[model samples]
Target: MKKILTAGAFMTAFFASSAALAACETDVKKDDITAEQATELYECIKEKMREGYGSADAPFSKEYQAWKVTATAPAAPGAHGKRFLITYANETAHGEYVKFSEERADNPMPVGSILAKESFGVTKKGAVKAGPLFVMEKVAKGSADEFGNWVYSAVQPKGKVMKIKQGFCHGCHAAFEDQDALGYPVEEVRLKP
Candidate 1:
């Protein structure tokens, strides 16, 4: 009886630990994110943005870093609903190159710019019920002119000037009316320092 009780206690403890760890792990490749992890990433970006701008006192500059993960819905007729994970940072911008490992030697995608792969709906909070998959790169750099303005641009490797499709942010937010319409993750917004 004593040995049996000890084994049962060990099993309970092991299961509890496993459950806790599972809750903390984020399956980004699967596009499954918990509200807690989403909130943590959101706040990190917000704080970094505030730091880069010195003060929140003027017309807000557009310098920021961000990423989004989207999962698509099933192809069946009425299916709908998707999830999105977006992370952003603000600071003095510098452009980075991007390169894909499988590309041919002649391929022109840069060497290090941050790469983003997004699916439309793998989690309950995602943006699309199911459909498009997007891959984008983000680069931050000071402006070319004398003013030395700041800029953050997301684009495809095929073309340098093509703008990213960030506009979908608004629509996704509207769906989760309780959350920020822009996928801002309100719970993570840090208080101004």
Candidate 2:
């Protein structure tokens, strides 16, 4: 009886753990996102962005550091000719970036990929001014290049969505249709281990 009870308890615990892991929505959705998921995603990245720009109370400062800096010196809206930095959130995205030149149209960022363009300005005194944070998330499967699939949003440093538009970003990036609507020249990204 004791053996049977122990086995039953172990099985129950295993199943419960599996269910909890499955509930984690790391993979981006193919179509529209649930309000809850959108909120969570926004909040998570927003918090990270806050810390990346130096927020004392922010969590996950080290976590954001793992993100690959794919591009720097890219032109941005309000950078005032200073430059911009682009970072990818995961290995899958970085892999796509590393192979994009060779694979061309064949390779694209996976579902969970998130790209952030951290716009910053340089002062004469060599101080850095953090600008708007632009984020692009690649949704799985479908690719009409809109908010539902490839979402685009610009966020302020304090976690405000300055803008969330699809056609504006998609239309410009769509010119690079071979690279899955990506704008940055990832061929220059020095892939780190």
Candidate 3:
């Protein structure tokens, strides 16, 4: 029984180490990584990301992937700490959100629409780093008047609800007055309307 227990422990450690080593990593600078390469990396890490987020027991984390993907590949932009971000739009948000419209004053995102963005970063030492899952949900008119009627929240990489300051997120998003505070993905990866 002792030998069997030892073998089981060894097997568990081996698999854990294998999983750790299997993480996606690249020496190439983030800016220089091509869409194909980014997609490849995404494929390698996406499942782990989903599992991590889903561990939070949040509806969005588990359901976002079933929604429409807004970009072909993750994009690294100045926003979101320059991490690579791939966005998803729920059914309520997809039709109007996909328009990537710049006419928000008159055509705002419908109430109930939700957007989820998954992020990841690469370190200077070439290690792939998982990031939080950002979420924005549109509430009924006047519900969250201070934040353009949208609520911003996040889930940590380990599935904890991240503490988010509404004002901080809104401060930057407010710059996009024409897009209803929506910051679309960079053009290179944006899916065609």
**For each candidate, what TM-score against the reference?**
0.24, 0.54, 0.87
Clashes of 2: 0
Q: Where is model 2 poorest over a 10-residue stretch in terms of lDDT?
A: 72-81
| Stretches of candidate 1 exceeding 4 Å from the true structure | 1-9, 21-82, 90-121, 124-193
For model 2 the TM-score comes to: 0.54
**89-118 in candidate 2: lDDT tens per residue?**
556577666454634565666787776666
Per-model lDDT: 0.30, 0.53, 0.88
| Residue 34 lDDT (model 2) | 38
Leading candidate by TM-score: 3
Best by lDDT: 3
Q: Write the per-residue lDDT of candidate 3 for residues 120-152, one digit (tens) a residue.
A: 888898777789999999999889999999999
lDDT of 1 by residue, 108-180 (tens): 2232322232212334332222222222232223322211111223322122233433444323324533321
Stretches off by above 4 angstroms in model 2 are: 1-65, 71-82, 123-127, 143-148, 186-189
For candidate 1, which ten residues in a row score worst on lDDT?
92-101
